[model samples]
Target: MTEETRRKAALVGAFERGAATYEQLGVDFFGPPGVELVHRAGVRSGQRVLDVGCGRGAVLVPAARAVGATGRVVGIDLAPTMVELTRAEVRAAGLSQVQVELGDAESPALPPGEFDVVLGGFVVFLLSDPAAALRGYRRLLCPDGRIGMTTFASQDPRFTEAMQMLVGYLPADRRRSPTSEHDALFATAESTAVLLRETGYRDVHVTDAAFESRFRDVEHWSAWIWSHGARSLLEQIPARRLPEALAEVTPVVERARAVAGDLVFTTTVRFAVAVSPG
Candidate 1:
């Protein structure tokens, strides 16, 4: 399969597996940090908002509430399962103004110049062509619209260390040589700034926030990994080695927990916001 096809398959498989419990696990993992980023973006009533890569409506639902009944929120995700999950969530919440569609962030299949605001959480780094995606988003906005995105910052030593401990068990080819995915994309502020400027966004600002999360224990961490795409790595290991892999990673989890206490772990995220030229 082509690289693009492979990435799409991987994303589909990951979200499909996570969908059943995404609302709970996703909120537990990302809700607070994402909410803070959206809150900082200052979503107001009567604004039409577009949520790109709206995984399970984690950001879209809250954003709909923030925008009130007078506004509308549209959520789009590449994965059909993710879109379905988010749609169900919007229904369960009794939110009439929120809609979820299966669509690509790189080339959102929406009418031009409709949205007053675009919000993306932990999405920019995942796009194969982030600049092109931003350019597309710029066109979707109503000239003066603003975009807000959240991504990892600083490559938290604790998180990196945890991921590194798992690398040994993964297929050699699958091992990520880069320390962090975010670094692979926006390694420097200047690079990110340049990309934003080139994409025709102005008044760009990047800021940071940190939050803590707790797992009951190593078992909980293991479950989280298995449920969220780490299972692919486990599949590469021999059945006999699976237990060893889990055992080996237990200490890493313990270390992260000890370092972070009952919180289990702490991570700092960077949020970038830019305004489309009027």
Candidate 2:
């Protein structure tokens, strides 16, 4: 298989395995950003919306509410487990306007110009070809339809150090963090805005929001890591090395502990929005 195909397969497997705990951890990491993404996307009542990589319905749930009963919200994910669980959650929440499907966020299989808004909450950077995905999103939107997404401007320094420290425990051939591979496209607000504009989007706007998430302790912090895309990295280390890996990462993480003892990390997120020039 091609490199991109292999990368996508691995990502799907990681997310499928992490479906249960993804964002279900006690930390408030995804929710705040999800809500902020929807609000910034300007989802209007009665509009048709498409939420790409709608893991656990973080963006889906709020967009559904924002669009009201008259609107339609279709969420797509590559992992069947995420799609299945999110479907159940939508039903349980009685969001009749939302539909969850097992599909690819990179290039959803739908007709062109069918949606009024398209949202990618902390998921665009994970795509195998983010620029191509942006182009596809433009095709999926109605005239002047908007697209809004969030990408990390910077991770907490301690979190970065801890992750870097974990890299030492991985086998020699598999010592790279998956996130590091795609950091350039999302390296800065101007860079992302330039990407959108180059891909035919207009009126690009980029803003930053800093979110602070606190974990009860070291174990809580470790579980939080395993609960999301970060698990991809942790899972690569040999099972036998996990304890030693944790032992090494602990002190680095502890340095971020608050006075009350909760581990705190502030992530700077960049929110970018633009209009399709139909």
Candidate 3:
């Protein structure tokens, strides 16, 4: 298989494996920022929207509401489980205008000149060819339509420290991120805006935003991290050593809380938007 094909498979595999936890932990935790991004893109009533990598209807549901019953919203994801979970939410919410389909970002089957807005939250950075994908998304918009995306500006410092502290528990060679098998993702606001302009978008702008995730204490923090992508780091420890590793990581969290609070984590993200020429 080609390198890009391999990269695409890895993205699907990682998210598919994390699908359950993502919906369980991510929907509520991530909803505000996702919704805020669509709002920044200026979604309105009677407009068609395309949410690329719509993980858990975080943005999809709000976009549907923004467009009201008169608009159409389609979400495409690389993981079937992710799309299915979001579709289930759509059904539960009675959003008949919202549809979820299984597809990759590299080639979302959306028709050109058909959508008024395309929003991708925490997704563009993961594409194997982000520039090419953005170029395609640009064509999907009608005259004067806009596209927006979100990327990590930085992780909460405590979380970053906690993660690093966890790495210290592992044996020497196995300490790197377990999720390294996936493609590299862009990680800053300025760089992302530059990419949008380079990919044929006009009037590009980047906005900085942050959201907080709280845990009652160290134990609560441990449980939450294991539920999502950070579980990759925990997987590096040997089965026998896992318990001991957790024991070691506990002190790190304790020290963090002393400096901060019982448990508060802040994730900073960048929301970048660019419009198609008329």
lDDT of each: 0.76, 0.90, 0.78
Full candidate order by lDDT, most accurate first: 2, 3, 1
Compare candidates 2 and 3 on lDDT and give the better one: 2
Tens digits of per-residue lDDT for model 3 on 133-188? 88888778898889988877788776777688778877897676533432233545
Superposition error at 212 for model 3 (Å): 1.2
Tens digits of per-residue lDDT, candidate 1, 62-114, equal: 78988989999999987777888779878988899999988888889899899
TM-score of 3: 0.86
Which residue runs of candidate 2 sit more than 4 Å off their true CA positions? none
Each candidate's number of clashing pairs is 0, 0, 0
Task: Provide the lDDT at 88 for model 1.
Answer: 84
Off by over 4 Å in 3: 1-8, 26-28, 166-187, 232-237, 255-262
Candidate 3 — which pairs collide? none
Candidate 2 local lDDT, 110-224, one digit each (tens): 9999999999988989987889999999999999999999898889999999988888887888786665677787888888998999889999999999999999888999998
- Model 3 lDDT-worst window of ten: 178-187
For model 3, what is the error of residue 61's alpha carbon versus the real structure, in angstroms, after optimal superposition? Answer: 1.0
Score candidate 1 by TM-score against the native.
Answer: 0.90
Candidate 1 least-lDDT 10 residues: 176-185
True-structure RMSD, every candidate: 2.5, 1.0, 3.2
Q: Give per-residue lDDT, candidate 3, residue 193.
A: 70
For each candidate, give its TM-score against the true structure. Answer: 0.90, 0.98, 0.86
